[model samples]
Every structure is written in C-alpha cells, then in structure tokens.
Target: MFLFEKAVTGSRKYWIWIVCLFAVIGAGFLAYLRQLQEGLGITGLSRDVTWGLYISQFTFLVGVAASAVMVVLPYYLHDFKAFAKVTILGEFLAISAVTMCALFIFVDMGQPTRVLNVLLHPTPNSMMFWDMLSLGGYLMLNAVIALTTLHAEQKGIAPPRWLKPIILLSIPWAISIHTVTAFLYAGLPGRSFWLTAIMAPRFLASAFASGPALLILLCMAIGRLTKSSGLREPVQKLAVIVTYAMILNVFFVLMELFTAFYSQIPEHMEHFHYLFAGLDGRTALVPWMWTSAILAVASLALLIPPGTRKNPKVLAAACGMVFLSLWIDKGLGLIVGGFVPSPLGAVTEYAPTLPEAAIALAIWAIGILMITVFYKIALAVRESLA
Candidate 1:
C-alpha cells in the first residue's frame, strides 16, 4: 500500500525509461482526446468491424494477466521453492497486465464515461458485464496478494494465515478472468470464428505460453540488474512451462484449422482463409498472420530441444518469438479475422489508423512503466532484506 518510497528511487536509465513512458502516455492521451471528440469513426472500425486494436489488446492482455497463475499454482499449491523467489514478479506482472486490459477497455468505449453504466446498470446476462467483473476482481485480488506478500517478506515474517485463503482464491480467479474474456467473443452467435468451446482453452494455452515467456525475459533482465542468481532456477522452470504451453498453443491452432477445413463450413473456413490467405483480394493481414506462424514455429524449434532452450541467448530469442507470435495471433489476427466477412458475408476490412496505434502503444507503455516501477519496489525490498 505504501510502496512508493522505493518506487520513486531508481537509476538514471530507469528514470529515462520512465520519462519516455510518460511522453508516450502523453501522446496517447492527445490521440485519445481526438478520438473522444470526433468519435470512433477516426478509427479503422466500420459498421461491420465494430471492435479494433483496443479490444484485441484487451483480449491478449487478459491472457497475460491470467498467465500469472502458472507461477502462483506451482509455488503456493505445490510449494515449489524455486518459484517462491519470483512469485512476486508474476503477481506484479499480472497487476500491470490487468491494468492495461482495463485501460484498453476504457479506451475502446467510444464514450469513456459510459463505462460506469456497467456497474450502475448491471447486466448479468451480458458477457461484457461478466468480463468487467472478472477483470476488476482479478486486478484487486492480485494487487492485494502481491502487496501483502511483499510487505510480509519485507518485514521478515510469513504472510498472515488469513491471507492464504485469499491467495488460493486467486488461482481460480485468474482462470475466470480469461475465460470470461473468451466468452465475450465466443458467446456471440453471429461471430462464427469465435463461436467455439475451444476458444477459452486456446486462450488459456496461448496465455500460458506468452505470459511466462515474458516473465522469463523479465527474470533474466532483473537477475542481471540485481546481480541475483536466485532467478536462475525459476527461469529454468518457467522456460519448461513456456515450452509445453507453446506446444499446446500450436496444437490448438492445428485443431482449429482441422475443424474448419475438414468440415468445410463456409462460415468457419472464411475467417481462417481471410487470416492466412486473401479473402476477395483483401490480404492486409495475410502477411502478418503468416509471419506469426513462422515465428511460432521457429520458437518451437528453439524451445522443444532441451539443448537450445538451455542456452540463455537462444532461450531469450525463443521467448521473444513466442511473445510476438501470440501477440500477432491473438491480438491482431484473432480479433480482426473474426470480423472479416461479417455475418452478412460482406468482406469489410479494418486497419488501425495512426491515432489508434498511438493509443494502443501508449497503453502498452503504461503497462511497461507499471511493471518497471512495481519491480523496482520489489527489488528494493529484496535488496533491503539482503
């Protein structure tokens, strides 16, 4: 709750990064203001493609936020000592990711003030309402758990026994956040591409892969900065988790392809076609999707083999590939693909304008800044303990 003492103190490079993040956030605010005044029309979103980059980011980050469970489950449930060191990092990452997810949702709303309506006029029947609830709850849950645990660690004492139940509750709460987000899309009747029971599972698999891959990179950087070898074991364990998750994620893609092509359902196959190839000569996203596939496969190549994965440089590259691949697959491809060939069979295309991209990038910068500050506080606490 009172962690700002450490957060306000950082190195020159850290301050520079924070300043850059602030600049980007400021620019994003300006862009958002333009959209706010002119309405969502300035965006690439059209009548058919209602959601764009903001929703896509929201969807992808929900997985990133949920991925925190990978670390939490092993540490708290199984009592894995290796993960005990970095569990705080994972929870803090979730806090930043969920914060971004909330911001994206807020930005996506044409009228930001209308967001309060979800709370004022609760709609239990709407998946969006459920998503809002889950995301909000998950954010609060992770913040409390992370803060309390860190506070206890700083005080050189165990977290209170009463906190254990709350910590345990976060395990399922994490899953629910992403599941509800998937349902927001999958439950839609006209959205054939998203209408699948496997959507949630696929979301989870990709989240597990991308989330831990990011954590691995962060752990490596933090280890170097802090001169702490404690992260080595946790990094290795997280790499294994990322490896299996990446494999499952790729398998899920295959399963989706098989379901679409094997059945030859026009509605289902159209989206895949639009994503991978061109639908009626509109192939804006074709190259991006293929590139994502290539990156994903290459990442697997580097990850599946233990020898390659053990090499830090190779592992870092592989982790980056996995993150980029999923970012494109889930963030760019999935959201945009679903809207192509809208329910009426019209092939309307959507691309983010400069203002839209700026706003999205701003949200990303904000998330990164939050992670930097939170991790700074966390590292300071660890240093004090040392």
Candidate 2:
C-alpha cells in the first residue's frame, strides 16, 4: 500500500510520462481488440513464417530478465558493495522484463486461453512447459526478493535468514530461464538455423551484456530523475561485464557463421545469406541485420578502450548501441531469420503489419510503465530512508 503511495505521488514530468504511456496503451489495446476479433490474419504471419515480432521480443526479454543475475551474483555472493545502490534496480528490471516476456507470449498466442491450456495439460517433456515454469518461478522469485530486500532496507535490518536461500536459488534460476528459452528454439528439429549447440551459451552471453547495458542506462536515468547519488561506480563496473559478454556473443555469432559457410551446407549458408545479403529476391531482413552488425562493431570500439568507456557520455552511447544492436539481431532478426528459407527451402520474408507493430509497441509501453512505477516506489522508499 505504501508502495502505491510512492508510485502515485510524483512530479509533473513523471505524470506526463505516465499519461503518454497511457495513450500508447490505449491505442495498442484497440489494436489488440481488433486482433482478437479478426484472428492472426490481420497480422503479417503466414504459414511459412509463423512467429514474428512478438516471439522475437519474448526471446530477447527472457535474456534481459536473466541478466539481472549479473548484478545479484556479484553483490550477494562476492560482497561487491559498489553495486549496493543499484542491485534493486536490477531486480526490479527482472520483474518488469519478465512481465513483458509473459505479455509477449500471450499476444503471440492470439488467444489468452491458450496459455491456460499449457498449464491445464501438463507435458513434462515439452520445452514450452519448462519455459513457462521457469519464467513464472523467476518472476515470483524476483518480486519476493525485491520487496523483501526493500522492506528490510526500510527497517534498517538485515533480510530474514530464510531469504538467503531464495536469493541464492534465484541466481541459477535466472540463468535457467534464458537457457530454457534457447532450448525452445534449439529443440525444434525443423529450424536448422536454431539447431546449433551454441544457442544456449549465445543466449546467456548476450543476456549478460544486453541486460546490464539496459540497467546502466536505466540507473543513469533514475539518478537524473530522482537525484540519487553513487550510481557511477556500479554503472562502470557493469560496463566491464557488458564488454566481456558482448565479446562472447559476437564470437558465438561468428562461430555460427563459420560453421554455416565452412560446411558448405546450402541450408545452413542460405540462412546467413538471407540475413546478410538477401536470398533470391527477398531482402526484408538484410538492412536490419547489417545495421545490427555495424552497431555491434561500433559498440566494441567504444567499450574496449578504457578512456572512452570510462567517460560517462560515451559509455551511455555505447550501452545504447549494445542494447539496440542485440535487440535488432536477437530480438528481431534471429527468429525471423530462422523461419526464412523455410523447411521447404523457399525464400519467404515476413514483416509485421501495422496492427502487429502497434500491439507490440503497446506491450513495450506497458513494460516501460511497469518500470516507471516500480522505480518510483523504490526511489520513494530510498528517499524516506534518507
């Protein structure tokens, strides 16, 4: 209830932001209602490329939710006090990201009831089942851990002893969510583009990078918006984490490309070709893939140099590049790329219809709204303690 107090009371600018989010949400809701009435036919989905923007966002956000561990592990396990200021930010991010992930799944399903069916009929062997279980469990874990830790802060006392175990469990639980999502892709025998053993590792590496990068940007924003102090050290430390993870993610991508072209398998090489150079006459993804490629390289340049990365402005730009680069590659291109040059070897390109884009935008705005309210509550608690 007090949390709601903090969230509900804010400056004029904050109210403006919330109102803007509401506008987007309202428009998106209208689009979704039409979708529910008309079925998926209103979207760009076809028999050839069934999953589009929604599933890609679902996949990318699973990684973002998992990346919270980058902050949690060091702070709790290693006693890295520099992260003390921003650890809650990471946890709140996981909560919001997971919420968005679930919403993306719901929208992608076309019918809300389909989600219940997954629960109503349990299939232990199914990756989708495990994915759902992992996501739901992670969401609860973060929500509890965040609220408990914040309450403990408010009282100027340590979190209860029992929370120790839950905190520890959440670290690995975070990793599991992304791995399971990767398995959802890698497990499909029909999607050759996602069949590689490296998918899980790639997902984890990118999660570590992109997730923390977003955290850095958000902490930067929160510091400005709330007039908070001591965020710089943690943000810089996170930059180093992003640096390493970005390297690994790019390496994993290169390895896939190497295997594809080196093996001279048309099925494999064709997917890469379709992504980078366009296969036959279809080139919808070509420009976006190239943009991701450029951003990946450009971000590496900014982050690898200590002077450039240590500078606050450059670091923000670099983090922005890191987030957007992976968002394009993994969030947008990855899923769409897999389905293209369909199992039958036809070059089919998929694009999101306007309503599809609107609905996706609404989902993103909803996530942003969650983050805004969550952070407002958190900042209020901190200010009160101060």
Which digits, one per residue and each the tens of the lDDT, describe model 1 over residues 180-268?
A: 99999888889999998899999999999999999999999988877776888899899999999999999999999999999999999
Q: Model 2: which residue pairs collide? A: none
lDDT of 2: 0.93
Q: For candidate 1, which ten residues in a row score worst on lDDT? A: 223-232
Predicted candidate 2 versus true structure: per-residue lDDT over 265-309, tens digit per residue: 888888888999899988888889999999999999999999999
> Under the 3 Å rule for N, CA and C atoms, how many clashes does model 2 have?
0
Summed over model 1, clashes come to 0
Q: Return the TM-score for each candidate structure.
A: 0.99, 0.99
Q: What is the lDDT of residue 332 in candidate 1?
A: 95
TM-score of 1: 0.99
Residue ranges of candidate 1 with Cα displaced over 4 Å: none
Pairs in steric clash, model 1: none
